[model samples]
Target: MSTIRDIVILCNNRMAFPAIQTLHSLGRLHSIGVPVENEDVKAFCAVFASDTGINLIIIEKSKLKFQLQEITAIKDLKFIFTMTFPWKIPEELIRQHPNLFYNFHYGLLPEMRGADPVFQSIKKQKNETGISVHAIEKEIDKGKIILRKTLPLHTDFTHGMLCTHLSYLASYILPEVLTLLHRNDEGMHQDETVAEYYKKPTIADVSIQWEHQDSKSIQALVNACNPWNKGAYTHWNGLNVRIVEVSQTDTLSADQHAPGTILEINENKGLIIQCYNNTQLRINTVYTDEGFMSGHKLLAFGIKNGEQFATL
Candidate 1:
């Protein structure tokens, strides 16, 4: 009979769901929410600590510190973890079981690596986006590549939608990757030349830079961050309405409406604003920090036709 390993999991929701389903079937079960200081995660850990065969500790990378509270007790505990959480791990942890520590990123490494990589790629208007399963280093996501694969994305996909897909990809690829990793004699090395890095998207990144970017780029920018991350921000009659939804228009004529002018307004057509190259932009929706408003409501809010919306 094959050796059945004992496992304890530490992760937040999005990841915890899938990782839980996969591993819980294979070994012992323990689940936790992010605010790791919570009652359930702590109580579960307290019970889990009683077992010696339960050597494996699978946790999201950031929450590794949750393990430290009762440090000396679980000192010899083994782990196979990922780094998507908000906590930190000591060098001693990684050094203890060098190969056991694994990090998963949603990108094709030697290319897209780091936070919001998929969002960054889509915003940059790449033809495709991919996911990478790599080991994590102290320098963050800079580690050896394990498995990399690109997934198809529809042009209409919003950042929220894309994240959902990537979350699925991470969940699906993880168990298989773990299986392969366990059997591997040596891990694969990544090429530094093709390696790309990124940071979390900034407020400036969410806003549209009208002058510097072309229409397609601008549209992609709008598409990439829609429904989340503050949308494609600009100015709407100085009201600071965010673009929540968009679609490139075949009807955008050489006619320039005022920046925030109602160049075109129809329930189906949305509100079109004029731009360079006679291009018109149709903003389907707008969102405030408090709530989201549709283009139709913009008119109700006293946004008149032919009036320009200035960028703030």
Candidate 2:
């Protein structure tokens, strides 16, 4: 039987809540670390600490060095786990406590090793995505892998939906991961050949590229940006709009109808728009200054079937 003890978790969001709960139940949690700026996590940690009598460490970025040093002094400290910690752990800390740190990445390692991999995975239309448990190295997400748990990436899955699934996945696999670490498993090095790194997306990255992208591609982009960004945005008739819900249609458009051109507006079908390769998409929901509205409601705003969405 493997015994796990005295683990600390550093996290920035609700995604780590399940993991924290699991550790607390197992009596292996030592304390929780939260960024001073993240109010929600700090508050959650405060309440949890009050109820469970566990320590809550506030991580001020400027004073992280001293705070981290203090944490290490706590008796019987064993392992440290981080999930979307917002900042990199100092190299000196990892060197001092060799193999003491592990991070849960929301996407598969090597293939998706960068910020916001959840959003990027969906935007890229990946057929599958996963969570990776790896040793924390000096570089971002460059650590050797301990294990990975994957789930099918459904076409209808939104960024928020995938995030929730990955969070639960992390909790579900924590015990096995801890057992592996306890047995002196150093894990395998990541293959650099297939590795990729993507930076955090800017507003421009979430915008719909109607001209060159096909209907299915556009739908994927929309799903990737849901809730977080409302949806993939575009401008039409001088009004900015976000397509909240969309689905690719089997219908084909005439050559004269360029991509982004509105082909028809059906009460039941919503707005039908031309897409690249003469394909079409049914726009179900949209967000504007008036808030979220059905795509067909654009008719009241003087939008017509022939008008095209602005390319920019």
Candidate 3:
């Protein structure tokens, strides 16, 4: 008879909540916990406060080693699944656990490996991205792949949208991955040749570069930053203007205008901004000093058709 594995899950973000609940419902999870220092972790724990069957422990990142040592003394923990866990596990602990440590990275392994893969994927205009379940190693996302599930990326998917979709996909495939691990499958090795890593997007990375980027690229940046990082930003008339949502327009202007110039403004058509490569982008939504407003409302804030957005 096959032995049942005792598994502990460490998660911080809401994306992993569905998967945690699934494992708990199946009676496959030993415990689910998060680092106590993070507010997001606390918020997630609050959602399950009434559940008597599931135990949620909040341990400090610094104390996790000792906590794990104590838990290992009482129970035979065969695996640790990390989902959006903030801190990096020590190499010594991983060495002790051997093949028992695994991480669910919300990106295709060997590429788009980093803090915010969904955002990076969107900004890069990738048509498809995926979730990678892999062995945890000292190097971030350099681990061998145990399982990977691809997700199609639509042009309109924002950071939050893509992440939510990937989270659902992760939960759906987790059971099969656990089954494979229980069967003593080591999974497949990742190719190092094609591996690429992306850093988390900073304010500068998301800042709209109207002079350098075409309409499609700018729209991608806006989509990548939405509902999480907020949106790609630019200064307009000394006020911080966040381009929350934009769309590539089919309209073309024969008039030569500098990039970032407001070519047209109409309530029905939105704010049309000239971009590189003779393309124009219609601003659908924006956030200004006043508050979030539609593109047509920019006129009320003193935004004129002849003015240009300043580059940061």
Over 4 Å off, model 1 = 1-16, 28-78, 254-262, 266-268
**How much is the lDDT of residue 119 in candidate 2?**
91
Worst 10 residues of 2 by lDDT: 1-10
State TM-scores per candidate. Answer: 0.79, 0.95, 0.94
Could you arrange the candidates by TM-score from highest to lowest?
A: 2, 3, 1
Residue pairs of candidate 1 with colliding backbone atoms: 61-82, 61-83, 62-85, 62-87, 107-131, 107-132, 110-194, 110-195, 237-309, 260-309
* Collision count for each candidate, in order: 10, 0, 0
Q: Cα lDDT of all candidates, in order?
A: 0.61, 0.89, 0.84
Q: Which ten residues in a row have the lowest lDDT in candidate 1?
A: 28-37
Ten contiguous residues minimizing lDDT sum, candidate 3: 1-10
Which residue pairs does candidate 3 place in steric collision? none
Which residue pairs show collisions in model 2?
none
Q: How far is candidate 1 from the true structure (C-alpha RMSD, Å)?
A: 4.9
